[model samples]
Target chain A: MTTNPNTSTLDYAAVKPNDTRAYSVRNILSHVFALVVAGFFLYAAYGKIGPVNARQFAVQIGNYKILDAAYSNIPAIILPFIEVYAALALLFPKTRKAGAILMAGMLLFFICAVFYSAIHLGLSIDCGCTGKGGSKAGWGVIARNTGLLIATGLSVWLYQCGPCAPKTSVDS
Target chain B: MKHIFGVIVILIVSVITGVAAKAMWYDTWSPTKAAPPQKMAWVKQQTSDAIAKTGADRNQPGTSGDASEKVTDNDAEVSDSSGATDASLTADAAVSNDEPEFSGGFPVAKLDMVVDHLINGTAHFVDAREEYEFDDGHLKGAHLLPSSAIYENIENLMAVGVLPGPGKPIIVYCGGGSCEASHNVAKVMAEFDYQNIYIYVNGWEEVMAEPDRFAGQTE
Candidate 1:
């Protein structure tokens, strides 16, 4: 390829074609939020796989007293993999919205479960956020889940096919 | 519409994978599998594995050490499969801390004594593990009084005639291995002035060590 020698080459004020700044702020923030939410769910899912974890999670759910013993096992078996799928979805462009929605729904469910256990039942039990050891169910866990819910919402809407995608950045 | 489809796909795949994984570990986590209590099941498997490993190592000259012989010699008599060798309630527990300080001034149950008690049904056995664990496996005729649910289930225990009675021995056990559920249950029982409460500090793990004899005793 030959340059046009007659033309002025310098365009210092304009963003360089290869500049990192060319990555739109919306895209960058979305990527960051997507990664954070994905990492959180992935770690959360890690501790819930396998039979030992299933047993612990079953007991944790039983602590909630909302579900009978027979019913709790269903969630114990399926919930971890749900988190895993949602996390992987968040990492992919095609399914990011689905992941965000699923995670947001899960956070809402968790917030309610914790609130019911802590406030309604007045039970001081292990939150079982992670399989074995995690914080107790109370205001702190609710606050943390709320933060993650907001993060998931932001992750979905910030860029690249999201409603909040910048007018200029196509993520090409 | 696209997001809904994607969400459904993720959920469907997750549910399928989870069910398949459960089937893969059926022996460990199958809901329909009617198995003995966890204590019995774990102890039996561990015992058999240890026996098989020991059989292979027995030919090794030094490895066939006198540990078993020492145990037999240290105790007045080793418990047979029926646990009928000793009739005493405290058959010289192998634990170091049996004093008042260890179990908060509570009497501790010996393994042999526990077995004998279980067989004879002379004592009320309180399972201190979670309800789910108790459902999986527990001592035969043991009361399902999980320490965490004690307040809720104590009345039920009374209704079921599993309540601790005067002069009758109460043996409380948990999942062992630093498990304090038994102690916690005992604390509550103490408040009600329950007599002859014996805390099994080693609990399920100690029973698991001799699972061949214990397995038949569990549900």
Candidate 2:
């Protein structure tokens, strides 16, 4: 194989295209994780955005007591769309990093909310995660959010470290 | 930066599409228009049939009308006609000329008033808690009419013969104070023209807190 005279041996090996099986695996894993997370968000958004369910979703948000009744409607209105957009972004290779980051941030926010509801607020209301009649907000909900966060983090890492990373002039 | 902008554009488009779809398809898209009111006469007819059924059951041979009273030794304070009158008067006075001063646009029932209805067997109790919560514990003779179920299949409730006719007073409750399930259920009942709907604001939690007051009747 012809190599660039100016390139160091280690640098050439690191960017070599032949040993791409690991990259393929990492890419596949990232896509799988992204799809799973995207499906979850889409399903959740569907459950929450329905006409009848949306009102209930708003009420559930109000029950958290984190926002006033007037402001509770805002999240009820916008969050579902945001979820849909994030899920869509995750489906495409070019936008996967942005999607992963957004999903991770959302999962972290949800974890904090669930944790507060379980520990600090001492509330026993529905978590409203799926937009329908959800189970009670408690440790289980926090754990679920934590799992999603970890998955999103993995997706971000794989996107950054695997074949999806941007090519530099040295690779060419 | 380009990806960020792309995400923002996607978000905006998603929201617009969602809003448009909701507006076009959902009858409940607008807050004010959700849950259109039912005819008062239809509600009256339903209530009358229920009352007639109750009357017929009371007259049946060997069936004791006082069975409920015997089951609970706690004599409700508002059982007497005079006490009922006073309670009704208090509730009426609380109402203004405009919107009713009740939580769910229905009359508010004090615990004693609810107990009186329970003893007399004149009211139907609807537990608005989830099925699992209802299964855990609930008032004796209470029907599980969860808010979510009602939203999904209101006809199922009517078909099941659980919802008493308009003539029978209905008492709805959830977990307890600040719990919106009961209120939401009550609103739906009111829209159906159930005129004598009442909300027990301090619901299962309060009843469980003072089991003696309920005469240990909770199941």
Candidate 3:
């Protein structure tokens, strides 16, 4: 990628694509956020599938009253695979875009699930957000997800548009 | 791409399904209904002993400085058998009593003393370990309640209906001094009003070392 020095107005213009500038910074933030989400999901899924079992997870979801009678065993058996996939997907550059979008969507769904459970269903259960550290469903979860959503959205979008073109010339 | 979508779909469906199943399985989160309180008999014996001691003291020459009333209030505070207070009050008080009970500061007990209390029916010693670790032969009577479930199922202790209230003494020990779960649990128990809480720093490693004294085995 190349950029003309005299005509560009973007602040990131000074940053070169391969010059250890905005590109690296952006990549670092994006990967970090992706890994964070992956870590959270992996921990949650592990709790459900490994030791704590999925009953607790189902109980939180049951607060929504959507599926009614088949909540526990389903999450217990399925979440580990999805979490592992999400974690792995973020590592591959090709898959990173889709992974970010998927992560954003998952977080959005969780926020909605918690909201619905709190207001519409009127049941209060821990969000199991922090794995065993006791992160419950509340404004904190929403706020945290909203921040991640913005960061992740920006990362995925910027990466798609391509980093600012190198300014020192391709030969340099 | 197709596989990823399939995996997401399955994940969502399963999470939703699991939620529904848990709601139907248990009507309430309390678990005391499954195991009756083990303290009632002990309470009864203590009450009778208290009454006998008080009676003997009252009959003595210069010991009539409000014996019965003080004894009555103390006994009633614990197990008022006469229903002067609601059951919830007693239950709440009992729950509070289970808080770590320490007097005159954090008195460090000897390892043998800790094990003796655990084995001689002094405290409900619990081992906060993973299921596999617990199944591979934990301290004989140690209850296997993992740290992960401690917060989620603490209300289950309320369900047990026999907690020693907010000031009870409880000793929490994990795998070893390096394990954080036991100390973490001890801290939470303190928050819940467990007054005399102690973290067995050496935990199982220390306990297992002297099996004859702690694990009921003559090594």
- Top candidate (TM-score): 2
TM-score of each: 0.51, 0.74, 0.42
Candidate 1 segments exceeding 4 Å error? A1-23, A160-172, B26-219
- TM-score-superior candidate, 1 or 3: 1
lDDT of 2 at B171: 79
* lDDT by residue for model 2 (A43-142), tens: 9998877777766677667666677756766677678888888888887888887777678778888888877865696755668888766477788888
Is 1 or 2 the stronger prediction by TM-score? 2
Candidate lDDT values, in order? 0.66, 0.66, 0.51
Error of 2 at B56 (Å): 18
The lDDT of model 3 is 0.51
Give one digit per residue, the lDDT tens place, for model 1 in A1-172: 1223355343333434433344466667887888998898888788778865676576667666678745878998899999999989988867888988899999999999999977787665557787654366789999999999988888777764333312333222
lDDT, residue B89, model 3? 28
Q: Give candidate 3's error at residue B129 in angstroms.
A: 24
The TM-score-based order of candidates, best leading, equals 2, 1, 3
Give DockQ for candidates 1 onward, in order.
0.19, 0.38, 0.07
Could you give the TM-score of chain B for each candidate, in order?
A: 0.53, 0.64, 0.47
Write one digit per residue (lDDT tens) for candidate 2, span B1-219. 886787677777767866775677554464324433363344446656755554454344563334423312222112221112122323323332222246634566667777877877767788888778889999888888776545654545555554423345677888886767677677655544344567888898889888778885678
